[model samples]
Target: MHLSIPPGNMKGTMEGEASPELKLEGDIPARYVMPQQDRPSAAAGVAPIPVVDLGRLSRPDADGGAVEEEAKLRWALETWGFFMITNHGIEASLMDAMMNASKEFFGQPTEEKQKYNNIIDGKRFRLEGYRSELLQSEGQTLDWSCRLSLQVEPEGERSFHLWPKYPKSLRDVLLQYASRTKIIKDCIMRALANLLELDEDYFINRTTTRARALARLGYYPPCPRPDLVLGFKPHYDGGALSILFIEENVGGLQVLRNGKWYNVLAKPCTLLINIAECIEIMSNGIFKSPPHRVLTNAEKERTSVAIFYGVDVETVVEPAPGLLDEKRLARFKKIKAEDYYGTVFEHFRQGKRLIDTLII
Candidate 1:
C-alpha cells in the first residue's frame, strides 16, 4: 500500500556535521510511494561485511574440520556482530527470484498493497511493518518502511494463511529461501553449540522447536532530498538471529563499532548474518548486539529482505549457564527474555541507547 514518510523526516540532514542531539525525524515526508529502480547514485565503499567461507567448515573430509569450523564461527562472532556467509547451500536462482518477487510486491499499486496490511486486519502482532504495535505502549514515530511477515507454524504448517498473497511464482521463491535458510541456520547453530560446549542438539532443538521464522520485505521509496530521510534508524534487532539479503548496489546499511559507523559494504550473493538481542544476552557480554541503521539515499530508492529467527516470546532468557564461569556469572545476572526485551524496548522508545539500560 502507499505509505509516505511523515512530514520532515529526512535521513542525513546533518551528515558530517557535529551535534549532540540526533535528528530522529527531521522533516519526515507525509507520503511515501514505492517505485521500481530506486538506487543510490554514488557508490559508498568500505571493507565488505566480514565473509566466512562455510565450505571450509562444511567439508566432512577435512582433518580437524569440526574444530576449524568452531574457531571460525567464534572469531566471526567476537569481532563483528554481522558477517556474510558463502557456501550456504542455497541456490543462486532462488535468491534472484525471491528478490524479484519482493520488488514486485512493494511496487504494486497502493490499493492492492493495502489489502494485506496486517495492522488493518487486527493481526498487528503478526503483521510486518517498520512499527510494532506491542511497542505502541511507548509512542514513537512509525518506522519509515512497509514489510510483509510469514512464519512456518507449528506442525510444519504450510498453509497460505501464514503467507501473504503475491503474484504467482513469488510464493515459491519465498518458500525456497525460507527452507534453505533453515538449513544454514541449523549449521550455524550447531557451530555455536560447539563454541559454547553445549550439546549440538541443544541449539538445534531449541531453534527448531520454538523457532520463529519471519521475513520483512522492505521498501524505501525515492526521496526528493535523500539526505533528509533515513532508510532506517539506528537500532538492534530484537530476535534470536537474523539473516538479511540486501539489495545489490543500494548502499545504506551501516553498523557502529569502536564508536564509529562502518559501512556494511554489501554485495550481491552475500547473505548477511546478524546477532540479535537474545544471542548477546546468552553470550554474557562476550559478543555484542551492535546497533545498525540504514541511511536514505540522496537520489534514489532502496529495498531489502530480512528473515529473522527468534525464540518463542514466552521463552525465558538468561545467560546460558554453560557459557558462564563463576567469574563471568558474577559479572552478569539472569532475567527473563520478555522482561529484558521490554526494558530495552522502552529505552529505545525514548530515543535512548537500548544497551545502556540493560548492560548494567
Candidate 2:
C-alpha cells in the first residue's frame, strides 16, 4: 500500500523552514519535551566501550593477533552488543565525502528538502525520502531531528527518483560507501558464524541475496532547550545489524549498559557496529540487542548516518540450528522479517516497543 502526505503538510516544523512551533519562543512545548528522568548525562568515569581492530583480525594467527581479536569480537557481541572498529578498510576520503554530502543536503533550503519528503508524488509510502518526525498520534512527542532515509543495497529495490538530486555527489558517494561497508559486514558475519562453531559461511549463505539495506541520515539542529527534547527515542534496533557513522566533534549518542547510560565518544574514521533484535533471536539470546538513544545538544548541531542490514522481508527469522539445543531451547518463535518489522513500526507509533513481543 502507498501513502502520501498532503501538499499543505509540506511545511515541516522540524528541520526545514522552521514553523513558529518549531522555534522555541517560550517554554519548550510539553509535547516536544522529554521527562526529566529520561534525560541524558555525562558518562564521566565510566569504562569506555571496547574497540575491535579489523585489520588485526585479517592478519594470520602466527602472531596471536587474530586470536585476541576474535576474543574481543565475541565479548563485544555477548556483552555490549556494540563495538567500534578501526582499519575497517573503507577509504578515509570516501567517509569524508559521504559525510559532506549528507551535510550539504540537510543544509539546503526547506523548499528543496520538502521535495523529497517521505511521501512521494503526494500518494506513496516512499520509505526512501525525508521526514521531520514520525508522529503517529495526536500530540505525540517529536524527535529534534530531520532525517533522510534511503535503501542503498539490493540496487533493484531502490527508488532513484526519491534520491536527493541537489547534492549530486550524495548518491554516488553513498553507493560506494555501502559497497565497502558490506565487505566489513560480511567479515563480521563470518566471524560470528565461526564463533558459534557453525560453518564460516553459515550466515552469509542463509541471508537472502535480496536482503534489505537502508541508510538513514539524521540531522539534529541545535535546540534552545536541549534537555527538553530527545534526538531519538530509547529503543533497540529491529534489523539484524547496524553500522553507524557520527560527526567527529558533535557527540550525543548514548548506550544503556548495566542500567547506566554511557556516552559513545566519536572516534575518527571508525564505524560503530551493533547487533539488532533479529541477531539476538538468531543467536538464541546469546548476543544482546542493547537499548540506546540519541540526545540533543543545546549548542552543537549533530549528524549521523546509520546503515541497517537485514534479511529479505519475507525470510523467516529463527534461532540458528547449530545454536539450538535441549538445554538452550528456542526462546523466540519463527517470525517473518516483514511481520517483525510491521510489529515494530506499529508499536513505535503507539510509543511502545517490540522487545517484549519477541520473547516466547
lDDT of 1 by residue, 1-360 (tens): 212222222232211223343233334322222122332223444634567767766665547865666566677688778888877887788888888888787666555665655554343343343322232422243444556666543436444754557667767787778888887887877766767777776556556645567777776655554544456666888767888988768877887777667678766687999887777776676666677877666555667878888765566665677776766662345566567655755676565754445565
How high is the lDDT of residue 29 in model 1?
Answer: 27
**lDDT (C-alpha, whole model) for all candidates:** 0.62, 0.77
- After superposition, candidate 1 runs with Cα above 4 Å error: 1-48, 60-72, 121-143, 153-159, 338-348, 352-360
Pairs of colliding residues, candidate 2: 3-125
The number of the candidate with the highest lDDT is 2
> Each candidate's TM vs. the true structure?
0.78, 0.90
Candidate 2 global lDDT: 0.77
- Cα RMSD of all models vs. native, in order, equals 7.3, 3.8
Residue lDDT tens for model 2, 180-299: 888888888888887889888877764545788899988887766766678887888877889999977788888888888777787898999999888888888888888888887766
